[model samples]
Target: MANYTDWNQALIDYFIKGTPHGTKIYLSVDEDVIERIGYHFGQSSTNVIWVNDFCIAVRIKVIFEGQVNLQHLKGRDSQGLPKGVAFLCATILAASQMAQEEKTSETNYFKRLREILALDGFARPLGMKFGNEAEEPLWREWNRWLMEDRFLPSAQRGGGAATYINYPISQSLLRRTDKDRLRKLFQEKQWQAEWDAQTLFAHVRREAGAFGIHLKDLLTENKQRHEAIVEALHQVYEQWKAQGCPTADKNNYCTWSRHLFCGLYRTEEPFLGQVDYYLYPKQQRGRSLESVEVKQGDNLHLLREERPGWYFPLEYSVSQKELDNGAKYQISSPNDLDYLILPARDFWILIPDAENPDSGAYASWQAPSLGTEFILLCKQELVSDIERLRDEHLLKSSCTPQPIFNNSGWVELQQCMVVSQAWDGVFIKNQALKDALQPSVKLLISFSGGLRVPKIGAWLVNHGPQITIFGFYSTAELKVTRLSDNQIILESSQSTNTSIRLDFSDPGHYLIEATFAGESSQRLVKIVDWDELAIEKYVHPEVMAINSEYHIFGSVIGQIF
Candidate 1:
């Protein structure tokens, strides 16, 4: 049996052989260490059958493998095994289990571990191998472990006994060792004796390099990078203060851009375009010709944050005779201009004019919903346009409205549909009811959140690329149409004047309401027939490039609007 002291020395020898450059490998093994650590392993045995950590844990199964090999701490075979210590370090590091010492930080330890482990089988071929210049006592000790199971051990197989094989302990447990304990272990003479002053300096230099710091500056008599970094920060603050102290002086104000200041300032009226208090059109264009009249208090204004090339809400005079038809704006408070808060990069404080409340506001609003029809329109008009102008999603993929239709007009590969919110709205017509029954067809409804049924009417023709029949109804039934496909059409009577095509072969989502004559329906397009190859290229372009620029753009921003 290998005594604790002999086993300790065996482990030390195994580690020392790998430290060609004399890097200290810290180990905390003592007379009572195994017993103390055994508690953590949920074992009562003081013999330490195994040691484990979060990253790598191993049990010392036996001294060696059958009769073919005896497991010495540093033992290696012709095939390879000598670099066990180095391998252990590697396993620990990859598991992020290196001890808490900054000197032995995971990165540094991992780097050193790699170098030593690489020596296993290759060292003998390199000639300056294990037995070169070996001392008598050291060899005796190593052989004792390999043979008599005193320092190392042999294996037991098929009911036979073996001894001395050292397996890795739990890397997680190793990392959990207290910082002070690790430091004390490093202070051992075995660790200090491995390196001379020069080797120590080199080690320090290597560690410094990992942090991208120069060794000379790090070890110099005076503190170097620390002071310089502090000075740089101070200079930045001084410059910012001198530049009018813009955001620093205002309350609830923060400057997101170094060149500009933005935030809410006090307002004189609640109706003032107080960005925080009022909601504005998410998008806006200049008002129409006749709609551009400004009251006595209203004047063409530019927003401080909304500048040269940016599109945002702003007052502009439509009067052809006015010289100041459009003028750049300066930052002003609510007293001067009522501002509404709209969410942007953070939040954009916008100014709203009461005289012409809708003056700078957006016109022709589209209903906000996750229904299939909306998604299809967005993919067609908005996504295509955005991709054409800029090779990116018009609406970022992160915020793209999810389609409500099961197939969702668009096909998704890895993309997942998340209905972050619930909505009640119009649905498409039912094909079964369209042909057999009356002119009006009722649609079966289904959706995630609880919603009320809505009354139906042809709200707008050609609302999107396709005509939309607005209906007042809601339901949770899985199937909407009598036909397997999710299609709904206007009852026969309502379809007479509509120029919209009712050709649909897939399922859909939307609202439908029962009427005395028949039924009214708003349709949600489930899957519009699209070239799969074209869509794939749009969704993932480099893989499949459809020959059209339109397809290219659509792929990038398929849900722009």
Candidate 2:
């Protein structure tokens, strides 16, 4: 048998020497020759040869179940041929015979060979047929070796080389189970890691190539599937919105968009119930029975009984229009009213109207329960329909479901407000007092007399003037302190529309605290110096201007001094 060196030299002489660049040569050999070379020729295998600074691509085909009838080796016994030399002899004999055939006939004969070799690193095996049976497991194994064994460089290592054994997949060859497997494989995160959408699609396509499907066709089908899923989700959202967004429904809501009311709940399964109370802004009036306009400079004092009590004493005069519109006028002392509702912005203070009944009511108000509750009254069937759609369209399609907003599946309202006090409103609080006459309200803090710089979380003001802080819709006492020294700067006990003027002569940070009905909220105010300001200009050297004479010239750029 010829050794490796002798075989290599023989191949170089017969295939490479004097061959022109871009020339393609075909060699057909018997199965024994391929076995001798220790290479498996599927339908065809290709190798490259360099000649005179050019490449000659050689395609080798194995003639199975038939004798090649090579005229040059007619007298020789096939079994006696040397292992490596057999491949070289067969190649030379085939080339000499094919060179004399008509060029058009030769081209038509090797058209399938050209198609197989056109794909990168792809080769067709004798056992596999196009649009027919395919050895999918064998192809998948080769591809896995190419990827995991680093047969080609990895993209993660900054190499763009890709190699895969691909076959044309027909729809008839794909079983239902195979398609399901492909769907699950497409969603695998391991293959998707560090891969962009295009690269990921390519990888998936290569995997599908093992099963004989093309990337373009798969992408077209996937796009249609994705659109169907998005449409299904939209229909479910519209149905839920039309039904008043009930919180107690069995349907799972997803955070798909910001404008949807379900996004406010921020939970897949939100706690649903009915709100039993309403919040209304407190009515401010003068000492007289008529409504009064209380100004910032007014020194009016709100009178309350000095005895220990939760409800502050305030007089409410029924208007004549309200009485004429069938309003009830019930004459009852403080003892008859069982609950007193103090609807402040930050604090919805609920107290027993009776004089000092027990310590429980006082403890409930003073215990710092500052959470807001949201109750969604949803129709049960609407949510069930959404869940059904998700399972049918999303789950079966192998599309991952959107994650639950809160893992606990419970919705917590961060801020609450009361719409009106006259109507019986639903009050949902952290503590569920069935008879509790409280409404959810939010605090409003407005800052004026300064340039607000949101990026630095500070307010910029001149050194001499004071910045005014106003708490609107709040019956809260205002307190200001210098944070650096923790010194009290201002403290006022005004109830409605309280405004405090703070001098920011020095540049530093200050803390403003507002306490209303035992609930306090603190805000940080940063003082900064405003010495000088000017607009900056950037001039481009390439920019030219024309004078009145229509002469274009470069203009000099000047900087602000």
Best-fitting candidate, scored by lDDT:
2
lDDT per residue for candidate 2 within 1-561, as digits (tens), equals 333334433433332222221112212222222232322112143231112001012222223332211223212224332223333333223322233332413232233333322322223334334321332332332222222211211111111211111121111112223333444454342231222122233344445445433322333243312222222223233323333343323322221111111000011212553212211112110001112211112332232322211112223422223212212222122222111222111112232211222222221221111221222212222233223333432111112222212242212122222222221233222211211222222332334444544323355554322323232344667787775687887787655444445676666666665666544444456666664233447664554435433433245543322
Looking at model 2, report the run of 10 residues with the lowest lDDT sum. 258-267
Off by over 4 Å in 1: 1-336, 344-367, 372-561
Error at 210, model 2, angstroms: 49
**lDDT tens string, model 1, 17-136?**
312110112332321223223333354544434323211221121112211111343454353333233223333343333333434332443343333333222111132122322212
Please list the residue runs of candidate 2 whose C-alpha ends up more than 4 Å from where it truly belongs after superposition.
1-442, 461-474, 531-561
Residue 287 of candidate 1: its Cα lDDT?
A: 12
| TM-score of each predicted structure versus truth | 0.15, 0.21
C-alpha RMSD of each candidate structure in angstroms: 30.8, 34.2
